[model samples]
Target: MTCNLAYNPRFMFLTKTIRYNLLAILACLLWSSSFVTTKHALDYQTPLTLAGLRFVLAGLIQIPLCGHLLAPLRMLRKEFFTVLLVSIFHTIFLYGTFFIGMTWVGGAEGAIMIGVGPLSSALMAHLFMHDDKMQRRTLVSIGFGMAGVVLISLASKPWSPVGLKEFFGLMLLLSGAVVSALGNVVVAKRKGGLHPIALNSAQMLLGGVVLLLIAFPFEGAANFALPPAFYGQLMWLAVISATAFAIWFHLLSKIKVSKLNLWKFLIPLSGATLSWLLLPDESPTLPSLAGMALIVAGIVIGQRESK
Candidate 1:
């Protein structure tokens, strides 16, 4: 026999909120680990090639889960164009810069750079989304987050000169974050009228094909043969992309963009922690830890004020 708890409205609401929060946290965990996995995969493949293969695999995996094979065909013209634009910003520019940037920076450092995404997204949403205007508390929280990024950058260059490669990597990462922020705003703006899975699948497939086409011309004579471990890394990265993005899109459909995106602060923390444990070269210094603390504090303040 199944047991049922008496349903109080408050309890039910709390329970639902907890579940959604847990799902968001889980998505962030998977996404954070992706930085390390992408770094590993880059050892065997160029950035564009790796990104193309990863997204193609993820897109194909999502297709069957979409239930209807012709879902894209049913979308309105406006919705189709919106999805295509999201593909360009979200997949092409975001992952292109992300993967290429990782080639120049350590996994943990790259992850820290991605910490800027939520703050930037919040600012963009304040400009574009009527319901998500930034209040005084949000402004303060953004200031804290920005300070944390500054601290992390300074910590990375305490004694030595920052090399050109490192500077370029930082720029690429910032570019990726900005493009990703724009994509988040776009998705939040176009809230209804299409299934999230279908949208993701279409974007991944289209974006993956585009990346591959570009990879062929620019990164000719690409090698596919690699160690067994490299293939494992590829598969894992693909799975992470598929699962994290699916959950993220679903959450975006249900939650306010500003409120939901505050959870992104966890990405850098998780990424740095996992990279420290998994990759010897990615251990965090003292100032980096302090910077992470500040970022976390900013997120806590933002979340409390939002509530």
Candidate 2:
């Protein structure tokens, strides 16, 4: 019995490491591919409804697996308000606007905008968070990063051919980027160590509920009923989101938060690469590639400096 019990932990540790890496890779792929999936879904839905439904559905799936953690809901009393605020930042300010902006923004462009997250997050950390501090090197890297984005935008077909609509869309997406960065900083600095799974579950559930409320008045549910043909796609969206969060939180639990943050730089690049593979005709423009390069350079420099 003693020998068997000892062997059990070794087996479990190996299993967990393998599972964690697999899930991390999957999370990246699923999240990157979300740009394409969102594009497909938009054909049959409005951005608001789509955003709301996606989170709500994802939360529903999570509830069953994570129901036990719900008992600790009361434990989060002091931080409950903080969690709610972050939930809004994610569901409304981040993803809500992101969905709407994606209507106007191509996958590649969306990827580039998303890359702004690391830089924005770093800035927020410097200003507001306790753990991270600012430095000259980071500032310089951020400048290069912004320059890259500016060049990409200028080189594009047109920044705003459709008047304020396109302009507003861009603004909204960028705002989402900033808010997302802020949320990351908050999570990093907040007191106490949360079980990543429980924390993630709570955030998603709260965010999804808020999204439903916002989307309901807009009648987002009306777009959800689809024929058998599209059911596969819906399943895909749900699986991708659920699996991504699970893996993401698991990784967060294992690694140092600062090191994990550096990995976010890959998101935009991966999104663009996947978008190119999935939708050949909608390939990234030369300028977008330039932006990708800058984003990468900025992240490397910024992380190096911060360290």
Candidate 3:
């Protein structure tokens, strides 16, 4: 018994690490699915309007399921602004650019572009976190990841030199990713200052409201008289957002932001693969595969210890 207990700490550490990684992977997987779903939904709805509906519905679903809604409300008084800032970047800007950018690129390209997020997250985590520093491996990974992104951009138009439109779109998509990293840093700083459900629900609600306001003025109204496919996509997106954001907030509080984000490497892999399978117009191309390989390699490198 004594000998068994002696190694218990190591076992516990390994268990905890595995659990966290699994949770991170789960969240990233849900996120990766959005590219395909959003693509289908976009056919029936305007960009910002669809985004608004997804988040608002997500928030509505999450808040009720939270069991005690008042608890989140109570918690919000102290952490209101923190959650607000998160909503601005995480929900509004992230989805805003995501919708617009997808118009210019296919689902796979959009997902790969979003995959560039962890590179930015690594840098931001170093700036904001005491435990996460920019190491040689991190630097090396960034170089590789940038190369991957460039390759992906070149491949965006599929076997042709990417024109200014695709380049601009990719940049817009990447900007959302950068702000999203900042948002993750914000959530990490809190370290569970708010309940994950509460925080996610609040941000989604607030962000959804603002998006609807913006959409009405600029993008115009959305038609609810639509096909089952559109509604199905919207429902799935909302479900995933509610579930994934809750998981993400929980993970952000518990794990090192940089280390946890290493799992995001799965996003590009899963997203692109799914896109190729689902989206009619999308298929594997040399530059895209090569770019994904480099990005995955960078993520592998990023996972290494500083030495």
Candidate 4:
């Protein structure tokens, strides 16, 4: 006879694990749509300027929502070094390279490239943490995840770029992913007593300011004046950053980096879907369908009870 899962301890435990996994999945989904949104926003502003402004607004919005800016401010005295490191890795380098990279590639292609992030994180974890060694399950998941990204990339998009720009852009994004993996390790390892949301806001504010500084010198003077529609997109991007990063950091603090990153394989699947749906000229091709299936299968295996 089939057992009632409600009374099964293993089933209950698995259910709880799935629930937390959903939070990270939600964050990935939000981040995936950013390719579409960021691409659109870039039409109105330079990449660096748009990225800097988005996170700055996100940081400002988050600080007040966390009940007080002062708590995060105070943590600077004690956790300033940690926060600074996070700002550099998580915000500045990660997002900086991402924005610049976006300039060279289409939304769907960029999103697919981002799918490799989990593999990168897994490698980083294996090298850095003694106990976080890659197991058979991780290798299998990585195989599926990498295959999925490859399949999706094979599907041609109308917006796909040709020539050297795309190559350079992808290289930058790859570099960003490598360093961003390190940021994940740092967040999981070095999170202090400060609340995750507070830490997220502080790091974002600092990094956003630095990005803005870099933008001014390279992209010319900033202009707050823009169409109201552009501001709407900016606000949505900010909300994505504020909410998703908070959820991500909170989960990172509790979960093992190697396993947690496995869920990021869903990013390209969701990102490509959003792009295909939202972009006027884009549509899902056969390879994309196959790719998404592989990503789903990989994530399912990743969630199994294994080290």
Compared with the true structure, all predictions reach lDDT values of 0.78, 0.65, 0.81, 0.84
* Model 1 C-alpha lDDT per residue in residues 156-244, reported as the tens digit of each score: 54434559997898799999888888888888776775688888888888788888888898887568778899889988988888888
Predicted structure 1: lDDT: 0.78
Find the 10 residues in a row with the least total lDDT in model 4. 153-162
| Model 2, residue pairs in steric clash | none
Better of 1 and 2 by lDDT: 1
Query: What lDDT does candidate 4 reach at residue 174?
Result: 87
Candidates ranked by lDDT: 4, 3, 1, 2
TM-score of every candidate: 0.87, 0.75, 0.86, 0.91
Span of 10 residues, lowest total lDDT, candidate 1: 70-79
lDDT of 4 by residue, 141-233 (tens): 988988998787677454554679898888889888989899888888864556888888989988898999999989997787899989999
lDDT of 2 by residue, 1-307 (tens): 2557546987887676567555655676677777667777878777776676677677667655665746336424646876676577656679889888878765435555765765776677677755567567766766666666555545533443455776687788889988876666556554346655455556766776677678777763555467664555666776776677756666655643443445566565566566567665656778878877886786567545232
- Candidates in descending TM-score order: 4, 1, 3, 2
Candidate 3 lDDT over residue span 1-307, tens digit each: 3568446897887777779778888998898888767877888899999999999999988877677867556545777898789999899999988888888875446656766787789889998888878677777777776677667655655444578888888888989989999999999988856678988988898898889999998887768899888888999999999999999999999987776777777776676677678779878789878988887788678765443
For model 1, the stretches where C-alpha displacement exceeds 4 angstroms are: 1-7, 72-78, 106-109, 148-160, 280-289, 305-307
